[model samples]
Target: MLKFKTMLILLVTMSIYSGNAVASPTSQVVKDRSYYEERGDIVWEVPTQKKTIAFTFDDGPDRKQTPKILEVLDQYQAKATFFVVGERVERFPEIVKLVLSKGHEVGNHSFYHPSFQNISKEKAVNEIGKTQQAILKATGHTAVLFRPPGGSYDQNIINVSKQNNLQLILWSWHQDTKDWRAPGVQRIANKVLKNVRNGDIILMHDYVYNSSQTSEALKIILPELKKQGYSFVTVSQLLSQKDNPNTHIKVTQ
Candidate 1:
């Protein structure tokens, strides 16, 4: 029993250490993008007013969660951005329609959501290109914004996005739901509510094991934000400026 207890303690320590190591990679990637690399024409985050936030859903247009999330937004009269994957959009075209019809914006999350930093330039182009075309065909609108898979990017990827005339978007803040672990709905909701601020961009997955939690959290978050004088807007609306024509531009082209 003594030996077993000692081994268990060691295992716990190792698990914590491993998690820190895994998280470090994302931080490193962000730092690399922020300074060491020139991101060309890709604007990582949108500038917005105080007390405003953009809620963006990534990897979605999902049949199950996307509709539920839309219903919640409808109840609050809130707007959001859905960064839909190309393959998924091809599979669930109706979800894209619902997103647009309901007043939400759709952006490109890529055709397959591959890692831009690791993939070749040709593959990177296809990743964004196919999705851009799919979004255009399905919704009859062109996607001007993109978020790279896993937030991994480099100079070549930025150049490709610029060539495609895309604005590369990233998050200002993240609510790490870890919903895949099936963390309870309340826990996810509280985490997001606690961390959100003005000019914040919250990231949540539309298709995942914990998608239900994401939907539930948004219901609580929207009302709470409203009470605090915050208005939910799609990414473009949140990032737009009166002086810049692109601010109010939609996908129609």
Candidate 2:
């Protein structure tokens, strides 16, 4: 009888202790971010709502890869945001049309994608303004969002973009496939599948870099994300879900 009682006491103790350990981390995070004001180099998501995610492609509107990426998105009926380089838009105007016609969105990625930190303010405006012109010319729509090349930006970069009436955009999280180096398709797919969550802004390239692997990974990831009950949306749409007060970041102009 004493042996059974001892075993029961140990099991009860273990369960209570384990629950506390598991619950403490979440409590700590809630405590930390409660007073934190989201600012630069920040990426976040709301926790208290339905599952949704945004997929954004940067440095794109490429001749080869953009079209293929579009085809896949069409297959899944997924909408996305394409941050097109101005020079690339000039080179592939039809790709821009395809992106717009399909009800996807286009944003500014600078005309030449130069390092915004080093360029003079005048040059910076030119880089972003030229792209805005190209996008408007191609799709008859002006981009409202701008993502600095390599995500390198500062107060000056943001100011220049806003002068052109473009909002500065950066991501909350990444799968970090490094697909530029031609990572394997399955490996890339697995990485995204394992990490993707609601309100995530997944970064991928729609240009000609590592086209095959990116396409293959898309084939795998789309179905998997769907299986997890996530609806794919553009970045703008993701930002529009503002009623879920648990959002990790909010931009107030």
Pairs clashing in candidate 2? 43-172
Q: lDDT for every model?
A: 0.70, 0.70
Q: Count the backbone clashes (under 3 Å) in each candidate.
A: 0, 1
| RMSD in Å for all candidates | 8.9, 13.5
TM-score of 1: 0.78
Alpha-carbon runs more than 4 Å astray in model 1: 1-47, 174-176, 241-253
User: Per-residue alpha-carbon lDDT of model 1 for 1-253, expressed as tens digits?
Assistant: 9998896555333331121111112122334333421323444344444577777888887899999989999999888888899999999999999999999999888898765544777888889899989998898989888888765555666677888888777664344455545577788778668876656666767777544887887777888889989888887887662233233211110
Q: Write the per-residue lDDT of candidate 2 for residues 1-253, one digit (tens) a residue.
A: 9998896555333421121111111121222222322442223333325587777788888888888888898998899999999998998999999998998999999998786534676787789888999999988998988877665544566567768877666554444455555668888788678877667777677874546677778999998888888888877787676444544543211
Model 2 regions lying over 4 Å from their true place? 1-48, 243-253
